[model samples]
Target: MAPMGIRLSPVGVAVFCLLGVGIIYHLYAGVISSRIAALRRRRTVDLRELLALSVEAAVLGGREVKRAREENPLEKSNGKTKGGASEKIALGDQSSHRKMYHLIKNTFPFLQVNAEERAPAGGEEAGVWNHVIPADLQLVGEGREVSADDITVWIDPLDAAQEYTKNLQKYVTTMVCVAVSGVPVIGVIHKPFTEYTAWALVGSGSNLQPRAPRGGRSLRVIVSRSHAGKATRFIQTAFGNETVVHTAGGAGYKVLALLDPPDEQYEQADVYLHITYIKKRDVCAGNAILKALGGHMTTLKGEEIDYRAAEANHGGVLASVGRDHRALLAKLQSADSHRQS
Candidate 1:
């Protein structure tokens, strides 16, 4: 049987083409609209939600950290880093780091993240998301628009490797910091062994309780235990002889001492003073947390650190809680004047 074909007139052909074009255009427009909606969702992230997510991620990472430590005890790592023992990664660190990296990436795919640990060393357990916002968190503004270019997430899966190696899990912490336009706006510090997490959103609020503020003379200063000799000498000369000096490991641990304080080695810290160059990730989270508490962190010369800088190294670190930040700097200045004469 021969097939019969219907030949279309010129006008009919034009109509058919227009119909095809219209269909294609509609499909394309639908796709574009969907894509735009997706982009908008990714671009706008609630700071509170980020804080909650960060706490969840940190808690999840902490589980891995504890498992790693228990499965295989960390022998003291032999190395050196800036101002303290070198950054030592163990089975726990790698696994925890990988877990944290994926969780944040999956949740906030559009964010640029900088993590201390890069790859997973071996097989490990995964984590579940529990978006936990603090009960006491009082968010500042209802909502503020944040552009994509202004946000970066900093992750340090295992903060106190040295202490961890020494079986001092008290100093160990898993940290996350969210910075916008070079300003750290959100921070989460989780103590794996203790199973406690502290989170803060800048210009918002945190769970930090009101404590009796301290300042001026008789200031209790906290410095790095690995290299405290120089710092102790400098701090005493700058502040005064009566200033109490306590030592601790891990920048995150030190910062925590400034807030709630620990009962042991790093006790009663009014301010955390590090007179050596250090990485931004080490301080970014703590800095954000302190900022939320109305505290301040700066360089030795009293200059604010721009967390967005490409070169992560900054010249020393000075963080003070409550009302003593400026006063500490002024005291240092006075000491400098006395020395110059």
Candidate 2:
């Protein structure tokens, strides 16, 4: 999900604990809200506004990523850390994720933020965060106003870090996704190298061109270039050897492949598969973007993911575009049954 080698360490735990704000505010603002009412309640939201702010937040994070690359401020961590969990981390990720979180907190401190990089418990000086919101941009249209309590912001400071470390600029991306009542409603993916951003507000519209129609004789499944052992075997077993599995870097990039044809000569993808470990931050933005285009993204079992889940989106993922999602799921199920028996 975060390139093969990169990982979200234990230090990357809930944001609330990092702030040292105590456990009282943890349920609504830090930990996943397991309340049945929180799950069932629906609130009218002007997703357009949140979508805009999220885009700005993503761009700010992208700037930090670029700076980190130029400054070579990358750092690695261990499995045990005072921050939260112990796992290898990047300084670029810390700075960028902090900036993204800082921006949102400054604007609206009450909103719950789910982030990959965990900062210190006390946080930076008062002068740390400064963000500028863009004034004019025709994004999403016509949405009912919603309360801030039901909003959750998801941020991935630097995706595809391994690729970026290797000077693979194209593979690097920064993403921001807004989830409302467990449903991802807005997504923003920004590429630092090209400075290009693609965003979507579900049920509204997007700034992207139409994706290439699904073609080719075999089912084209795009996957992580970093880790493909399981996905490759699954395609071979489930769809037979005729299936084409294209390997690339970053969840955002793979999702982009499903959206449109690459600048190169390769064919567009029908689905993006990750039959392995992946956190919600890894795929939530892509999920929102794909859904905006009228596509499907869910667990391998075809279950909708709750963004506020305590465990995060830990199961394997299967995302299909411009195809029969149910039919694909049905086929996958049949194959699994045969393999087990």
Candidate 3:
């Protein structure tokens, strides 16, 4: 029989307290999730707009390159200069390309603004945000800034220069990254040319969800199909020798490859990390999505990839599931050394 009075045991009281805390945490999580979702919506729209501008720039740059190439070198050589009386054409196609790149690069601040605006005054947020930027893409780890908020975006508007220059149908303009400070969270890789987008939200436990034009397919490791070099071989060996590598161009495409299904040419695997040189212009939009999802991203050497400095060689990147695969990285490093030797 039950007691008439409200007989509560000590354990019962403790359990009630725990339940109350859990309820509070649940509500807090809901609120935070909602805020994060709104941020993502705004950020994504901004990125798409920038990407459009970048593509336009690339098209215009291509025209310049073509015109410069056709600038009658023979006629200039035939003319006479002050020394030998010859007139130089000095067609500035390269200069035009640089201007186009800068146009896209300069637009990063608007996408993820500085974290200083959101951080508490006089807090320990210094050197934590990005404020520098890079001058070249061939190099790594340059020009970027650090902010109070732990978010970054990586974008490569025109990947596969050969394909892009050739006006190939398969080329991709991509944007992707490891969002937040270090965790590889949500990621978005969209192919503007094809109107295809791949996104994933990674947390403690990983779940692969899909978007339109396709159903939910599990996220996988997408690599360069054509550039099957020592690095690719090592990845295949670790994840599985038979792992399928997708040859999608562009940084954004690679990030998307982690989530997007394998088309007729590329088969998908079950792991991915969209690592990039720590640069703001290359990462902001994609970082927002990755953070919102769940996973985190960092350099292969396991340090915070700062965005405030402006140089290009921030070492390589490692983004994946489960725990950090240091062993795989070691293998790649070893392979690289062996190849060099």
Model 1: per-residue Cα lDDT over 221-295, one tens digit each: 899887789888888999778989999888999898888844344486888988777888889999998888888
Query: Taking the tens digit of each residue's C-alpha lDDT, what string does model 3 give over 245-331?
Result: 555543344444434444323333334433333334344434434344432334555444565333352555554433335654665
**Runs of candidate 2 exceeding 4 Å displacement:** 1-45, 73-88, 117-122, 125-136, 261-267
Candidate 3 least-lDDT 10 residues: 123-132
Model 1 ranges off by over 4 Å: 1-42, 76-78, 117-145, 215-217, 261-266, 333-341
Residue-pair clashes per candidate, as listed?
A: 0, 7, 58
lDDT (Cα, 0-100) at 60 in candidate 2: 86
Please report the candidate that would top lDDT against the real structure: 1
Alpha-carbon deviation at 260 in model 3, angstroms: 2.1
Best by TM-score: 1
* Clash pairs for candidate 1: none
Against the hidden reference, what TM-scores do the models get? 0.79, 0.77, 0.42
The window of 10 residues in a row where model 2 has the poorest summed lDDT is 124-133
**Residue-wise C-alpha lDDT for candidate 2, range 187-285, written one tens digit per residue:** 899987778788888887887654656465688988877557766887778888999888887888888878772343333688888766677887899
lDDT agreement with native, every candidate? 0.77, 0.73, 0.40
Window of ten residues with lowest summed lDDT in model 1:
121-130
User: Of the pair 1 and 2, which is ahead by lDDT?
Assistant: 1
